[model samples]
Target: MTKLAEMQCEACQVGAPQVSDEELANLIKMIPDWAVVVRDGVMQLERVFKFKNFKLAMAFTNALADLAETDFHHPGILTEWGKVTVTWWSHSVKGLHQNDFIMAAKTDELLISGK
Candidate 1:
């Protein structure tokens, strides 16, 4: 089977479920680094963007914002000295929908492109 098939099957095994608060929290703990637990009890996939300085971080943030706007899906972003934390969750579902994973993969692509 293809990778997509595998992922889909795996998701289905979990009932194609939207992650519960407890489950999401456990998953985040299992997958450390560049991820956090959100205040709304959702999964927040974060990445620490190390830029040369604050200026670069701001520029990246702007570009990232544009992408999010175009997708019509937004994430919670926290900008600091040289890092940006991005968190994604489906507010409508009040949990983690498949769209969250798709966005997370796209977000990973964005980060990979930067490298």
Candidate 2:
């Protein structure tokens, strides 16, 4: 199977079907560090990336912003002194979509690439 990081995101529309339980089970394996969270009754994929200091955390935040622009998908990001919390979900669908998984994998890649 192709790695999620290597996959591209598809345009998500309102009413798009959220991932099924089986699909979530499989996809979650690829991003084991991420947590599936429900906020306001919507499922979201979330993870926290740690950094050395505020500067590094901000750098990663900027890089992630660029990546989101490139993918045309955005995530809720909270940058702190030593870590950044990223939450990915399809706002259009108001739930978790495959795009969330794809972006989560890509976000992990940013760390692996030393962003």
lDDT of each: 0.61, 0.94
* Native-structure RMSD, model 2: 0.7
Among these predictions, the greatest lDDT belongs to: 2
Question: For every model shown, what is its TM-score relative to the native structure?
Answer: 0.64, 0.97
lDDT of 2 by residue, 4-41 (tens): 99999998888889999999999999999999999999
Predicted structure 1: lDDT: 0.61
Runs in model 2 lying further than 4 Å from the true structure: none
User: Candidate 1, clashing residue pairs?
Assistant: none
Candidate 2 residue 65 C-alpha distance from true site, Å: 0.1
lDDT of 1 by residue, 23-70 (tens): 556545533444655665754566666777888778778877886776
Q: Best candidate per TM-score, number?
A: 2
The local lDDT score (0 to 100) that residue 65 gets in candidate 1 is 86
After aligning candidate 1 to the native by TM-score, how far in Å is the CA of 70 from where it should be?
Answer: 1.3
